[model samples]
Target chain A: MKKYLKYVVILLLIPLLIIAGACFYPERSYAFVSLIAVLLSCVPFFLSFEKKNNSTRKIVLLAVMTALSAAGRFIFAPVPFFKPVTAMVVIAGMYFGAEFGFLTGALSAFISNFYFGQGAWTPFQMFSWGIIGFIAGLLSSPLIKSKILLIVYGALAGVFYSLMMDVWTVLWMDGYFNIERFFGAVITALPVTVKYIVSNIIFLIILVPLFEKKIERLKTKYGI
Target chain B: MNSFKNLNPYFLISYFIFVLFISIFSFNPIYLTSGMLGALSYCFLILEKKNILKSIIFYLLIFLAVAVLNPLFSHNGKTVLFFINDNRVTLEALIYGAVLALAVVEVIFWFKCFNLIFDSEKIIFLFGKISPKTALVISMTLRFIPNFIKTFRSVNTSQKLLLKNHRLKRYLNSFSAVITQSMENAVITSDSMNARGYLLKHKTFYSRFKFTPTDLFLLIISAVLFILTVIGRTSFTYYPEFIFPDLSLLNCISYFSFLVLSFIPFIFEIKEGIIWKFSVSKI
Candidate 1:
């Protein structure tokens, strides 16, 4: 009952609340509920990892991956839309399982924001990257075995990432999810989305084969 | 008097929740007054004078825009004031807009204070209690970021010298080199931690923050006031007509409680100032 309660709230109560708020109040509840829902979904995964031991090495390795992605963000700051973070996070997900991958993606988004700036967009950024890494982790076998799947997933992940952020822009500008505003935001973000796809594919192609060998060596060496 | 930052994480988090709740949930004149006064005092105490002036001017414009915009679009109230472009603007709608704007401004001020209060170490400690491993990992990740940048710069410079004229290739190689090296370093680090008996005592968590007796007192007061404010919230309606609740005992009690709740940090700041002044005089 207790376990199901959170699902009940996340799945049922929150959307109901959104509907109710959207109907009555113009702007307030949608943003908070959506962001809260994204963040709450992450909680259970993190807590599950907390139960496991031999966690020190994994944590350290996760740290290193996160730093790499954040640093990748810094290195690519000169470019308009080219960032290695999503690709690296996808690779982390493929190699290190979903939770750590999520952490890498989320934390990189978070820590890197300390450089850029932090605001309402931070949670949305964290959620988008984290979810992409999570899905990559779930599809790890297919992602690793086939080159085409890796590139396709990379491109798709970029599209997903950019679109998710656009959703935030729309909800923020207008009170509700105005489709017109959403379409406008997406159209404006089209170039960035393409760049995202290009960078993800480019980095994945560069990093995957190299990391497979390195990570395989890591797994065997550390028994992780 | 104890400083606000020294307050326990639990109490601090609750106080923020309480204050934000009161600000967001009502438009009662009492609630608005307390929240605005509290927010203003805290901002004055904490923020730079120049920044406060700037934000006040900025938010004032925003408040005016929001209050004006609400009546233009929202034709919900009974007392029609004016019309722009054949749309009826109501006095009630204007009031609602002002309330909404106040709520927004108050919440922003509280959030600004939140950012000041919840530093990384405090955040790590608070979350660490919930999930120690993830907290430890997050803290480690933050630590490693600077290290990675330092190593990457040195490696980039060295790689640049060796590679000689492929800037992109040099940076790429440096990134990969640092990646591999960091993974190896993690192995050594984890092994060293294991040797030192890390994670053997899973039940124990170490944190720098201590919840002293003063925090407990504050926590009790916060909890009581939060409950009072919740129960004493004045019912307000703004659709057909603006209905403002009259002054009642519960409303006044909650208003006073919310005032105290919001000004707790400001109170601490003042007390600390006075204590310092007296100490200097005695010496």
Candidate 2:
């Protein structure tokens, strides 16, 4: 029962809440639904570490990775929308496991927003980056083994993040999921989306090898 | 002697959560106006005057952009305002846009206040009650950001001294070195915590915050007000057609209750100021 907890949460509870929200409270469902999704994501994150030895190591590593991902934004500030935050998050997921990846990605967004300024979009950003990291972790074996697949995943993650955020934008603007307005938003956001994908691909190509090598070394050294 | 800022973190968190959610979900002009006024006044009371002006101006720009841009994309509603490029810009759409813009800005301002009030220590305190490890991760990540940045810069400078040309490669190499160093540091950190018996079962945690009577009273009041406001919100609609609930005694009562709910923090702040002034005069 405990082992299947994550699947139950991610698949059953979240969808039920979203459907119920949409059915009963259409006007207010977006925020409530997404907020619930974000909170639910944290369940798998915390559950993954339950009763595990060396949990301290995992937590510290996650904190470092999150901090690195957040600071990565500052390092690439000279380049517009070209930060390696997504790359760091993907690498964390690939190395640490899905739960740590999710936590790192979410925390990085939440912490970095202190510098960038928090707003209504913060939760959406957190959910997007977090889910990206979580999925990356789930596919860690293939992602770590194949360079091509890793690069492809990076690009898709960028598009996915933008798409998730665009949902928020459309919902905010139209107060509901207006398909026409949503498409308009996607079109309007195409340039930034392209930039995001390109940057992700570039950073992944550069950083993944370095991160994987270091992580492999640490794993062997500490038996993590 | 207690003030708004001195309210229990839990109460403050609940208040902000209730108000922000309410502000975002409701679109009735009355609700939006009250939310905006409440957010603006609370900000003025808390933030420095210069920051207040800057944020007000920033939100004003966003408000104008939303107001101007909405009519271009959305061509709904009955009253046509003008036609640009054969697009019928409706007055109703324009008003809806303004309301949407105001809602966005109101939420933003409330978040600004939320961020100001809920600093890192308070966040850790709140989260710590649920999970100590989670709070530890938050606090550690917060600490590591500045430390990592400093390490990155020092690594970059040292690398710069060793190599010329290929600045991109140098930067990447320096960053790679920082990654390796941070990984090693992570190991050491975990080892140290392990040595100290972290992650032990039945671990005890400590916090400085205590729930006072004032906090309990504030929480109860805010929770009741929140329920009332939510009830009030259900009968109101803004899009497609703005349908406010008919002007009945119950509707008026709920509306005023919501207004009071939104302004609770501002009321507390003003009360604090008045009490402070009176005490100083006595002195």
Query: lDDT of each structure?
Result: 0.79, 0.80
Task: Pull out the clashing pairs in model 2.
Answer: none
| B147-237 per-residue lDDT for model 2 (tens digits) | 8888889988988888794777776777788789988999999899989877566887777778999789888988898787776534555
The candidate that wins on DockQ is 2
| Tens digit per residue, CA lDDT, model 2, A57-163 | 77788888988889889876777898889888898888778767777888888889988887777777877788788888889999988999998999999999988
Q: Give model 2's DockQ, 2 decimals.
A: 0.65
Question: For residues A32-63, could you state the per-residue lDDT of candidate 1 as single tens digits?
Answer: 66767677766766766777664677878888
Regions of model 1 farther than 4 Å from truth: A1-36, A78-81, A109-123, A145-148, A166-199, A216-224, B25-37, B55-102, B159-171, B235-243
Assess each model's interface with DockQ, reporting 2 decimals per model: 0.50, 0.65
TM-score (chain A only) for the predictions, listed in order: 0.86, 0.88
For residue A94, model 1's alpha carbon misses the true position, in angstroms, by 1.3
